[model samples]
Each structure stands twice: as structure tokens, then as C-alpha cells.
Target: MADELTTRSALQLRDLVAHGEVSAEEVARAHLERVAATDDQLKAFVTVTDDAALAHARDIDRRRAAEEPVGALAGVPLALKDVLCTKGVRTTCGSRILQTYRPPYDAGVVERLRDADVVVLGKANCDEFAMGSSCENSAFFPTRNPWDLDRVPGGSSGGSVAAVAGFQAPLGVGTDTGGSIRQPAALCGLVGVKPTYGAVSRYGLIAFASSLDQAGPIARSVTDAAHLLAAIAGPDPRDSTSIPKPLPDVLAGLDDGVSGLRIGVVAEFMAEGMSDGVRAMVEASVERLAGLGAEIVEVSLPHAGYGLAAYYLIAPSEASSNLSRYDGVRYGLRVDGATTEAMMAATREAGFGSEVKRRIMIGTYALSAGYYDAYYAQAQRVRTLIARDFAAAFETCDVLVGPTSPTVAFPLGELTADPLAMYANDVYAVPASLAGLPAMSLPVGLGEAGMPVGFQIMAPLLRDDLMLRAARALEAEVGFDAMPRGPNALAGAAI
Candidate 1:
């Protein structure tokens, strides 16, 4: 019973726990067992709060026994990407600098998840400071792709996706500044959502890019992602950037289906440079959606060509400013030196991974006074143009469709040598983030070398429900349930 329980979704687990088929304690214990057995090679977690998780589960059980009303996600387990602050837990963002740091308060989302009765299994690994496109930047260890250990798990949020794909957890939270969540979801063969900028609160979340960072969920299925989003999405007074609109029940209308949905396929995404297998998979997904009554039309975002340059300038610029707070002063791993500035610089140099340093330097250079107009301001103007492009495209369509990543999961070090190539992996995704639109990656097919490919769906801001409905529709049609299989305990396959 415990073994079978690990594969169930948060929604399914909730039902079982509510009906007494499985206790909240049993669900937590099973997930804890899976994490202990598999996380060594997967490196999915930086910290596992076994005692606290079980205690929370037991409290839920006690509440149920007392006949108190239980939340919709009661007793289900979820993994937090180490970027989110959790009180009393070491919330390292896969960086050595803050390995022993414990946040004083739970992030707004963490508090809400706790309120919803979701058990947090642990803090999952991520690219240090969420800088890299692959998980390799983690200072401790890289999170291996669940499909093939020898390959990379598309990242920044690689551990979150790997945790879900490897069945270590039913739900995982990730942030997408520029495809961090969706790219990993694409590679790991799972569902990941990046809500419109400010759709979810960023308070207590270690900032990546102030304007673009948004925390969301990675799950095995679209509905599971929706349920997790429903739990975490809402305005928070603590975060001024959080949208104040009431969050509609995302899971309420899942059965509405996707007939008559206007889903536009961006010509820019379908153009040359994409892998043949990825193209075929996306084309097949479009056809499948068309068969389901989606009006597939070609749309153009001409300025989309400039997205990479603009994102590179904008994201890093913001990252440089946001990361300045970690100067070894107020928190963990401080280094004393002859002078304060030297000490701070030395601490950062020794603490951050190479990717983090690269971005900070790039941002510092770009934001310098003489270069500001040439880079930062120009990038902002380009951002406006990109947002306008999406607006114009949305005028004729309800949603947009394309491949989430240009290619599937590449090998571990394939693009690490070329920073530009690494940034290009986010080609299809940055446009949506720049526009503050809701987007999701749905596993569509296997790409070259049989790695999972994701079909990205974009919706107008605040219309996450429409995008999710369409994705769930495509999910049913594609039926892409390609989990890695063998006698390797699923651990060896992922590690």
C-alpha cells in the first residue's frame, strides 16, 4: 500500500487520506522512504525535513481524527526547490555559501502550502543562485536526468523536475526566470508551469530576476500541476509585485476540454535551427490539438529574434542587483578580511559557482553608466517590443503553441563551454517570461536520442486556466508517459 501510494498525485493522495484508505502518516512515510533510497545519486534534495514532515503529517491525521475540516491537498507531499525560504531548514540554493543557512520565516508560498496541509519532503537542489540552464551548477552535485543518468536534466530547477519524474515526489515547486521550470520539465518528461509574472508571490523567495522570477509547480500531470498551483497562487501583501486579482479555481474546470480553443503556432518557433525530432514532435502535437477542435493558425513575433540578447542583458542585470545582498554579512558563511569590500568580494568569489559569477559580471558590465543605455535601457525597449509582439499575437489567438526547448536534454557538459549556446536553450521560453504571460511545458514526444521533448503552451496574462485546459487536452492526445525503465532501481537510470 505504501509503495503504490508514492506514485499517486497530490489530488489522488488527498482523496485516499480523506477516505481513510491511507493515513497522512503513511503517505509522508512512503515519500520519506523514497527520498532516502533514491536521493543519493539523484541529488534531488539538499535537505530532507523528515522529522518535521512526519510531525506535520501526524498533525493532519490528528486534525482529521478530531473531525476538523481538511484542506484539498491534505497529507500530500511536495518538494520545494532550495530557492524558497523555509523556516528552520537549510535553504541553500545549491550554493556552498549558504549551506548552513536557515531562513527565519517561511516564504509566503511555503506558509500557504503548509496552510493547505501539504507535507514538504525537503529542499530540492537547483543551479546555484538559479543561474544555469542545466543542473550542473549546483555546488554540491548535479541532478541527473531521470530518463538517462549520463545526460543533463534541463535546469536551474533540475532537481524539482527529477524528483517528480523519478517518482521521488508527486509534486515539486520551481521558479522560472527564463525557462528554469519548463526546460527541466521538458527534459525530464513531466508537467511544469510558469505563471504570469506576479501571479505567484516572490516574498521570501531568493530573487533571481525581480521582474521575471515567478515560482510554480512541476508535476507528473497537468491536473496535478493545476492543483499545486491552486494551493500556492494568490496575492500576498508582503510582495508588492504579486497580482491582487482573485485566483480562479484552476482545477475546477479541467473537464471543460479544449474544443474551440484558438491556439496559434508561432512561426518563429517552427523556423530553422530546431532539431528534426523536436520539430516532428511539436508538429505532431499541433496536429493532435487541431484534431481536438483547436484552431491552429500560424502567427509571427518578428522581434522574437532579439529575445535572447534582451534576456541575457535584462535577467543578469537584475540578478546582479538581487544577489548583492548575499555579501556574507547578514547570513551564512561570512569571511573576514583586511577590508570589508575585499572580504565581501572574496566571499562571493569563493562561494558562488562559475555560472553565477559569469552572470554577475555580465550584468555589472551591462548596467555600468556608459553601457546602461546601450544595454540595459535598450533591453527594456526590446522587452516592450517583445511584450507587444505577444499582445498582437494574442489579439488573434487565445493561446500560443511551440516547442519548450529547441532540443531535448543534451549531455551533462554539452553546452557548458558556450554560454551563448546555453542561453539559446531558452529561446522558446524567454518570450513568454518577458511578456509576463502564463506558460506551461507538456511532454509531447521523444527527441533525438529518444529524450523527452516538450510542447510549450502560452496564454494571455491571468488566463492560466485556459492554457492548462489546452495542455491537459494535449496531454490526453499525446499520451507521452515515457518514464525510464530497467533493473537500475530508477536511481541508476537517473544518476
Candidate 2:
């Protein structure tokens, strides 16, 4: 019965708790036990807050018993990516520097989650400072894809998505800066959302690429993703970039099928480089959408090819600026030296990992005198062009469709030796981030090695509801079997 509870969707669990069929404590314990059982193999979490979770669950049960008002996601268990600040709980962005650093206050989204009565199971792992495409860059440990133990769970939200996919959590919150959330959600066979920039507050989220980082939901189903998005989507005065308006009704028209919706297929995305199996699966997904009455059209984003190069420059430059606050004098790890400059250098050298160092170097170089205009400034220009492409394309289509990644989950260390190869994993997902548009990845089917392939749906800026509606429509048609298979399936079953 506990394992059965673990397999249920977030909404299903919520319903059970609401109807008195089961206590929230039972649901929380079920997932916590699953995490304990599998995290050694999955490495999906940096910390597990069993006590806090049970306390929150019991509180929710008390509120229900008293007939008091409860938030939308009351008692749902969730995994939070370590990038979000959690008061008194260590939030390590998968780096040694801030491994012991606990925020004095919660991030805006975290506060909202608490208000919604969501029980955070723990802090999920990620690439050090959310800089890498694969979780292997973690200063602590790499997260393995649940579909195949030897493969990487896509990152920097690898652990967050893995928790959901591996049945350790029903929902997860992860920040997407250049595909961190969606890519991992793809590899893990989950519904991952990258809401439009400012759709969710970025106030307490540790900076990556400020312009690109947006926190969103990773869930087992599209409907669950929408519910999670609703809980955290409103404006926050703490975040200057937050959209100063009420969030749209995402669940209002979620069930309205995409009968007459126009879904544009990016001609460039279909050209080459992706594995044949992934391409076939994505193409089949598009066909399935068409069969469900979506109007299919081929659209061109001539500047789309440059998105990768532009992102590498722009994201790194921003990272360099944001990370400079981590000098020896501040809150996180500090290495002492004879002089201030020496201490700063020593602290950074000791604190940051190899990938973080590589990006800081690239970013500093790009932002250096005489090179800013040629690199960082030009990347910003390319960003504008990419946004223009999305705007122009959206004029003819309601949303764009493509493969979330070039291939499914790859073995650990496969691309670790080649940074360029690792960066290419975001080729399909980055354009939406660069454009600050809303995008999502949902499993269409399995591809090579029996790993999941995601079909991405993107909408114009501030149109997250539209994007999710299309995803839900297709999700209903595809009926993706999100259950884990093989040995991993047995793990969940035995939990």
C-alpha cells in the first residue's frame, strides 16, 4: 500500500489526503522510504529532510481534521533543486563551496511552496553551481538516470527530475537556465516546464545566468505540472525581474484539446545531428498531434543555429558577474591567506570545481576590456535576433515543436572529456530560454537504449498556459507510460 501510494500522481495523493482516504503523513512516509531505498543508487538528493517532511505532513493532517482551508497542493511531497534557497536547510548547488551554507530566509518560490502546504523531501543534487549539462560535474556526486543506472540523469536539475522519475517524489522544482530543467525532465520521462521569464520569482534562487534562469515544475504528468506551476507562478516584489501581475489561469483551459492549434515544426531542428531514433520518436509525436487536429507547419528560424554559441558567451558572462560575490569575506567557504587578494584567490580556487572554473574563465575573458563588444555584446545581439525569430514564427503558429535533446540519456563520462559535445545537449532547448519564452518537455516515447525522448512545445513570451494546454492535449493522446521498466521498475514496485 505504501509503494502504491508512492506510484500515485501528485494530484491523486492530494485527493486522497483531501478526502480522508489517507493521511498526509502516510503519503510523505511512503516517498521518504522510497528515497531511502533508492537514493544510494540514484544519488538524486544532496539532503533528505525526513523530520521536517513528517512535521509538515502532520500539520496538514491537523488542518484537514479541523476543516480549515488548505492550499492547492497540500501535503504533496516534492524535491527541490539545491539552487533554491531554503531557510535553515542546506542549499548546496552541488558544490563544495556552499555545501554547509543555509540561507537565512526562503526563496520566494520556497515560501510559496510552504504556503501551498507542499512538503519538501530534500534538496536534489545538480551540476556545481548549475553550470553543466550532465550531473557528473557535481563537486559532490553525479545523479544516475533511473532508466539506466550507468547513464547520466540530465542536469543541472538531474537530481530533481530523477527523484520524480525514480518514484522518490511525485513532483520537483528546478530552475532552467539553458535547458537544465527540461533536458533532465526529458531524460527522466517526466513533464518539465520552463515558465516564461519572470513568471516565477527568482529572488532567493542562487544566480546562474540571471537573464536565463527561471524556476519551474517537474512532475509525472502534465496536469500535475500545471498544478505545481500555479502554486509558484505569481509576482514577487523581491524579484525585480518578476512579472508584476497576477498569473494566468493555467488549469482553466488545460483540458481543452489542441483541435485547431497550430504547432510549428522548426525546419532547422529537424535538419541533422540528432540520433535517428530520437528524431523518429519526435516526428511521430508531431504526427500524433496532427492526428489530434493540430495544424502542422514548418517554420524557419535562420538565427536558431547560433543560439548555442550565443548562450555559451552570454550565460558564462553573467555567471562570472554573479559568482564574484563568493569571495573569501562572505558567508560560504573561505580559504585564509596572508593577504586579502591571496585569500580571495585561494578561496575561489579551493571552492569552485573544474567546470565552474572553466566557465568563469570563459566568461571573464568574454567580458574583459576590448572583447566585450566582440563576444558578450555580440551574444546579446544574437539573443535579440533569436527572440525576433520566435516572435516571427509565432505569428503563424501558436507554438513550436521539436526534440527536447539531440539524443536520450548517455552513459556517464561519455561527453565529460569534450565540453563542446556536452553543451550541444541544450541545442534544441536553449533558444526558448534565450527568447525568455515559456517551454515544456513531455515524454513522447522511448528512444535508443530504452531511454525517454521528449517532445518540446514552446509558446510566445507570457503564454505559459497556451504551451501547457498543447502539452496536455498531446499528453492525453500519447498516454505516455511514465512507469519505470526493467530493474528500475522493480525498485519502484518493491518500494
Candidate 3:
């Protein structure tokens, strides 16, 4: 019974716990046990709050015993990416500088999780400051894909996806700046969503690129992701960029199939850099959608090809500004020196990893005095053009479709020495992020190397529900298996 608990979806656990078939404590314990059993090899978690998680679960059971009303997600397990502050829990942002730093208050989303009664298993690891395309840039360790233990679980949000894919947790929260959530979800063979820029509040979320960093849900199924996303989506006065309006009821029309809806295929995305297996799977998924009463149309995003170049400039520029707060002063690590300037330099030199340092330099150079207009301003103009491209494409279609990543998961350290090669992996995902659109990566089926292939869906800004409906409609048809079958997966697990 305990082992079976680890295999159930978030909604399954919630129903079981709500109906008294299984106590919340049992559910939490089952996943914690799985974490203990597999995290050594997967390195998905930076810290495991076993005691706090079990205690919270027990409290939920207590409340239910007294006939008290519960939140929407009353009893389910979640793996929170370390970038979100958790009050007493350490929020490392997967960087060595802040490894021991704990926030004094919870992020807005964390507060929502507590209200919803979601049990957070732990703080999952990630690329230092969410800077890299692969999980290899973490200051402490790398996260391995559950589908193949030897490969990366695409990154920045790699650990969050790893935990959910490996059955250590049924749900996760990962921020997407440039495909951090979707890319990892694609590689790990799970579902990951990136809400529109202002759909979710960013208060207490450690900023990477303030304009692009939006946290979303990671789950094994689209329904579970919708549940998680709704619970955390709302306006917050603390976040100026947050949308004043509320997100619609995503679950209400989730089962509304793709009949009579137009799904646009980006001509640029399907034309290049696709591996044979991934191309085959994507084409097949599109055909399957067409057979489900959806109109298939070809759309062109002329400026889409420039998304990667613009993102590298804009994201790093914001990162360079946001990360300047860690100057050996207010919080986190501080190395003492005779002069204050020397102290700050020494601390940063030791605290930041190679990738983080690299981006900071690039951003600094781009935002420097003379080059601001030439580089930074030019990139913003290009970003506007990408948004226009998306607008033009959406004029004729309800949603746009493409392969999430060009290829499936690659072996760890394969492109570590080649930064450009690693950055190219985000070609399909960066465009949507640049446009501040709601996008998701849905697991179509297994592709090259028996790894997962992601069928990405993009909807107009604030219309995340359309993509969810489209994804759910096809998810039912394809029936992709998310359970990990790797050597490190839980015993009895199958792909």
C-alpha cells in the first residue's frame, strides 16, 4: 500500500486522502521513502524536509478528523525548486553563496501552497541562479534524468522535473526564464507549464531575469498541472507586474477536446535541427491531433529565429542586475577583508560558479555605457518583433505547436565545454518566453534514445487555458507513460 502511494498522481492522492482511504501522513511518508531510496543517484533534492513534511501531513489528517474544511489541493506532495523562498527553509537558488541562507518569509506561492495543504517534500537542486540550459552548472551537483540516469534532465528547473519524473514527488514548481521548466519536462517525459508573464506573482521568488522568470507547475499529467497552477495563480499587490485580473477556471473546460480548434505548426520550428526520432514523433502527434477534429495550419514566425540571441542578452542583463545584491553585505556568504571593496570581491569570487560568472560578464558588457543602445536596446526591439510574430500567428490559430526541444535528453557533460551548443537547445522554447506568452511542453511519447519528446503548445497571453485544453485533448490520445524505468527508478516502476 505504501509503495503504491508513490505511483499515484496528485489528484489521485488528494482524492484518496480526502475520502479517508489513505491518510496524508501515509502519502507523505511513501514519497519521502522514495526520495531516500533514489535521490543519491538522481541528486534531485538539495534538502529534504522529512520532519516538516510529515508533520504538515499529520496536521491535515487531524483537521479532517475534526470535520474542518480543506483547501483545493488538501493532501498532495510537491517538490519546490530552491529558487522560491520557503520562510524557515533554506532557499539556496542552487548557488554555493546562499546555500545556508534561509528566508524570513515565504514566497507568495509558498503561502498559497500552505493554504492549499500541499506537502513540499524538499528544495530541489538546479543550475546556479537558473543560468544554464543543462543541470551541469549547479555549484553543488548535477541532476540526472529519470528516463536515462546517464543523461541530463534539461535544466535550470532540472531538479524539479527530476523529482516529479522519478516519483519522488507527484508535483513540482519550476520557473521558466528560457525553457527552464518546459525543456526539462520534455527531456524527463512529464508535463511542465509556463504561465504568462504576469499570471503568477513573483514576490519572494529569487529573480534571475525579472522580465522572463515566471514559475509554473510540473506534474505527470496536465490535470495535475492545472490544479497546481490554479491554486497558486492570483493577483498580489506585492508584485507590480502581476496581472490585476484572475485566471479563469482551468479545470472546468479541461476535457473539452480539440474539435473545431486550430492548431498552428510553426514552419521555422519544424524545418531544422530536428533529430529523426523527435521529428517522427512530433509529426505523428500533430497528425493525431488533426484526426481529433482540430484544423492543422502552417504559421510562420519570421523573427522567431532571433529569439535565442535576444534572450541571451536580455536574460543575462537582468541577471547581472538582480545578482548584484549578493555583494558580501546584507545576507548570504561574506568573506572578510581589510577594505569593504576587497571583502565584496573576495566573497563573489568564491561564491559564484563559472556559468553564473560568465553570464554576469556578458550582461555587464551588454549594458555597459556605450553598448546599451547598440546591444541591449537592439535586443528589446527584436523581442518586440518576436511578440508581433506571435500575435500575427495567433490571429489565425487558437494555439501554436512545435517540438519543445530540438533533440531529446543528452548525456551529462556532453556539451559542457561548448556553451553555444548548449544554448541552441532552447531554440524551440525561447521564442515563447521572449514573447511573454503562456506555453507548455506536453510529453507526446518516447523519442531518440528512448527518451521523452515534448510537444510544445503556445497560446496567446493570458489564455493558458486554451493550450491546456489542447494539451489535455492530445494527452488522452497519445497516452504517454511518465513512469521512470531507469536503473534508479523505484522498484517495480516501468516506462
TM-score for each model = 0.97, 0.99, 0.98
Error of 3 at 344 (Å): 1.1
Computed on alpha carbons, the lDDT of every model, listed in order, comes to 0.89, 0.93, 0.92
* Candidate 2 residue lDDT tens string, 205-250: 9999999999999999999999999999999999999999976889
Clashing pairs in 1: none
| Model 3 stretches with alpha carbons more than 4 Å out | 486-491
Clashes of each: 0, 0, 0
Model 3 global lDDT (CA atoms, 0 to 1): 0.92
Q: Give the TM-score of candidate 2.
A: 0.99
TM for candidate 1 is 0.97
lDDT (10s digit) by residue, model 1, range 258-360? 7998889999999887899999999999999889998989999999999988999999999999889889899967877789998998889888888999999
Looking at model 2, residue 327 earns an lDDT score of: 92
At residue 345, candidate 2 shows an lDDT of 94
Candidate 3 local lDDT, residue 160: 96
lDDT tens per residue, model 3, 1-495 = 777898899999999999999999999989998898888888999999999999999999999999987888987999999999998899999898998999999999999999999999999999999888778888889998888888999998999999999988899999999999999999999999999989988999999999999999999999999999999999998999999999877888999999999999999999989898899999999999999999999999999999999999999899999999999899999999899999998999999999999999999999999999988899999999999999999999999999999999999989999889999999999999999999999999887767889999999998998899999999999998887665543344311
Kindly report which residue pairs in candidate 2 clash with one another. none
